[model samples]
Target: MPYKPTVVLSAIEEHHSDGVFTHTTVSRARAAMVRAVQAIYPLYFETMSRPPIEVSDLMARDGEKVTVLVHRHNNLFRTPQLIAVEGRIITTAKATPLGLIIKGHRNRGIALAPTELVDAVPGWGETAISALRARCEAVRALLPRETAPLTAGAISAIPDDTADAASCTTVLLTSTQLPYEDPVHGCLWLVSDRTPGSGEDILNGVLLAPPTSSLVSEHGSIYAGQLPPYTAHLPTAAALTYAEALDLAGAINGKDPSRGYLSALARLDAQL
Candidate 1:
């Protein structure tokens, strides 16, 4: 019933496997929201090919159960708009023993019937195919991404980056020791290639990583792979992609940009 909120909510739902509350600043999730609106509400809203500047304020106006709160180190950066379509978007392909699918994506795939099952249940494949076809037909009705005008309010909605930067207070009790958890710590990067607020293609990034030892950034880094200066406990400036950030964050650490930034803030808040 609700237009914009549904779109926004759907986009957030698409990427979340763990069913957690998502923030407005996540660009990847927001991009998915952009795509969700296009797919679901095509007639009223043109399936935008480009992302917009301010979907945040729109939700506040639109009738939806929206909540507001601020974290210590609040930021809403977006990852790229990859994987818009879910495993629900099915395709026919050959699956292999090596867990690879050929010709088509077999992500979250299903086989009509295994060889023995087809033999044991003669009409099973036909019945399964028929049902799947109907389901896919229903899916075809909804699917699509893109643009809206830039609003002045949207510009204002962006937090005062200068103030946030100025508030960077990393108290080093001992100058000889790096304050952050050694071997790995927090980081953020300014990826100009990404869409700012309304960008479907881009969002800025946050990271919790050790000094860049071996990880390589997708767009590379302003500091190559080394740690940036004066970033001991504050989010420092650099260039990196979500994947690259995650890589540097390592397999054990969490990879969420929003949560990552919050954690960075929480750590610094203790000293203050």
Candidate 2:
């Protein structure tokens, strides 16, 4: 005889008033029933001193009510290993040529008479399964998005006083906008002189110049600062040049880029 993986057979009947079953409904019902059983049985076993009572011992005596069983197997060295076991209850004890048939929620299966069955939890029946399924579905519906959105933040320097600042030419740059592209090498210029129209003058300059005298002449209205222009929509190549120029200028002024532009760049890199 071929060895069949041990399956537990119960003697319970699931009756539908409509007496109709569809493939989809039956599959769903079986899954729900299994989930219900799995959830309840663990808690029920935890209450016992020696939980998961063995199937052989539970089936030794007749008329003993059992809801779950712990199926045990032996390894190569004969060490007992516990494996997951499922049991079903049949509705009738009639001796048919195949075996006794058991019906679960929207499903049925055949099992032999005098089957080795054990119970783990009492009152574990189709009604309990249905109730548990409903509760699980309700809880699932209340959950938020399957995955949460990612968030990020950063802190950098900004100008403390815009008017009449004699100490430093530029203050730290701080903005919520992210710099997606590298700044133009030598073209990244900022004006911290607090001139009447310095902001507009800085904005008008062409980005990423090759550090020529004409480039400075074009935007000579305001004194240039070491900080890079952080305005959006600059091309990547230009942004790179500006970033390099900002770093060089910062180095020449003996100011650590981390105190300003470097910090902002680090935050953007983290997001990526």
Candidate 3:
């Protein structure tokens, strides 16, 4: 007898429907079908490995406060396949009148934040869909998906209109680093941290006098969105130095270490 490929067993079954078939023939056919199914089943943890960004908010009705942050890790997912959008609203009690807060602190301090959504845009669902489709295609091309027949394309087919009614807007927060230079000048700033005295002290350079207005200033750094939790806004560089000084001197230092040395070197060069 000649050996035959496994798939031929199926054809044999079809031809020999009226004839007797051996158990071996049936078993071999079943095995071949199993192999074919396994080839396309797409086995991997690619789908489950995505960072889940889901929120569970708890606020009392008519007598509570809530602060939402758009970029906070709790409100963001790291997966590229999903879309993210951020939306914000301020709610205040008519009786006591405490406005809502939506905060994203550059510092480690708690930002009195307002609620925002990512990935789900309200009125701009079409735009969001377009963006996600383009993004998914890009992700598919550049990064190999662990699962073939990945449900990525299926996601794009999901209706964007449904996103509008979503309680919070969906924001798209990719795991990739944002692409841009720092908008705020790399200067030290004094921001409100809900402590008037502390805020004022930092602003007045009592805590740590930062660079001169010419060298560093806050032309467009502060935002109405950042009114609560009075914080002194300092540039990353300035903050590092201020933190170091505070750790050692317990105050902000304004004196430049290189000032006198640079002046002396310039004078010597002039004489030469």
Native-structure RMSD, model 1: 20.6
Q: Which of the predicted structures, 1 or 3, would earn the higher TM-score when compared with the native?
A: 1
Error of 1 at 49 (Å): 42
Q: Write the per-residue lDDT of candidate 3 for residues 96-197, one digit (tens) a residue.
A: 222222223111222223222212222223354455344334322221111122122322332232232211111110111113621111122222121123
- Clash count for each candidate, listed in order shown: 11, 27, 40
lDDT: which candidate is best?
Answer: 2
| Decreasing lDDT order of the candidates | 2, 1, 3
Poorest 10 consecutive residues by lDDT, candidate 3? 168-177
Candidate 1, residues 1-272, lDDT tens digits: the string is 31110011222223544679533433332333233222222111122332222223222232222111101111133221211111121122352211111112434432222110100101123343344333323322332112122233332433342332322111110011234522222233322222333422222333332222322222222321233222221112232334544454343244443333333323433322
Model 2 deviation from native, Cα RMSD in Å: 26.1
For all predicted structures, in order, the TM-scores are 0.19, 0.19, 0.16
Instruction: Put down candidate 2 lDDT per residue, 1-272, tens digits, no spaces.
Output: 52133223111224565669522212222222222232233223333343433333433333332233332223332221222222343333442322212222223433332222223333345544444344334322221112111111101121333544322222122111125632222122233233333332222221212221222212222222323222221111112223444443444234432123223222222321
Model 2 worst lDDT run, 10 consecutive residues: 147-156
Q: Show where candidate 3 strays beyond 4 Å.
A: 1-123, 145-272
Q: Score candidate 2 by lDDT.
A: 0.28
